[model samples]
Target: MSSMKKRMIKGMVRWSVLPADCILNSCIINIYKEGDYIPPHIDHHDFVRPFCIFMSKGNIIFGKEIYFVGLSEFRGSVTIPLPVGSVLILKGNGADLAKHYIPRVPWHKVLVTLRRMDHSKIPYGFQSDLELEELRLYEL
Candidate 1:
């Protein structure tokens, strides 16, 4: 594994948000600019719950039914601010039942998401990284 990825994993482990046995093998980096937004939707079942590390200030909306308020605005039952350096672990009803999305960002924002791939969803010919096979969080 790349040293950078190893460091990121270690940092996430230190947060103790995910289970000690959870093995995260994939990541998604999101970069949003002013007026950029993600529409509300539930996560696909292709992967386990995701852990998101926020790198900038923003708000994420979550609700059973998200309503559109304007071209770059939305309203949900709950709005959570994602402060810089905050880690959010999604699971249970928060992950399965509630739909979530980011409204248009006011400025530049970034997020790093980590997740474990479901065995059935592993792409053909993709090999698991041996180094990550036994990865576990350290006791915090």
Candidate 2:
């Protein structure tokens, strides 16, 4: 994970909104299996600082119906495909604004991988077998 942190610090990522006096705080590597998907959710917590996601495998399919305030809605959901070596950096605030989810209808399955940096450290990987409870929320 430290190696990944170093890579991110050296990588060039444009932020949608930049904060004052920001630093490379932390990183988490999320690997999702096939048919695994995240439901509609937001990372609007106060402690979650500006973060970025480097896609390792598969693609993140955003829901068309679900939306967050002050964020752009995808036209019938967008497929963010990433090859093995490619990377996708979401500007901290804008990335936070996007409401991410996997729709039950049509039964689409996608892996929305992320490497988030915050003021504090968060546990890496899925915390539970239940899809809805996979992402554990903690105060950072």
lDDT of each: 0.76, 0.44
lDDT of 1 by residue, 1-140 (tens): 56676676766665665664566777788888888988998888787875444557778889999898988677899999877777678888898899998888878888777787888888889877766665666664
Window of ten residues with lowest summed lDDT in model 1? 13-22
lDDT of candidate model 1 versus the reference: 0.76
Q: What is the C-alpha lDDT profile of model 2 across 1-140, one tens digit per residue?
A: 35554434433322312232343344455445544545566654533545545544455555435644323323335666656555554544345656655322223333233333343444466232232222222324
Which candidate comes out best when scored by lDDT?
Answer: 1
In model 2, how large is the Cα lDDT of residue 9? 48
Give me the runs in candidate 1 sitting further than 4 Å from their true place. none
User: Candidate 2: where is the Cα deviation over 4 Å?
Assistant: 13-21, 47-50, 67-76, 102-140
Task: Estimate candidate 1's RMSD in Å.
Answer: 2.0
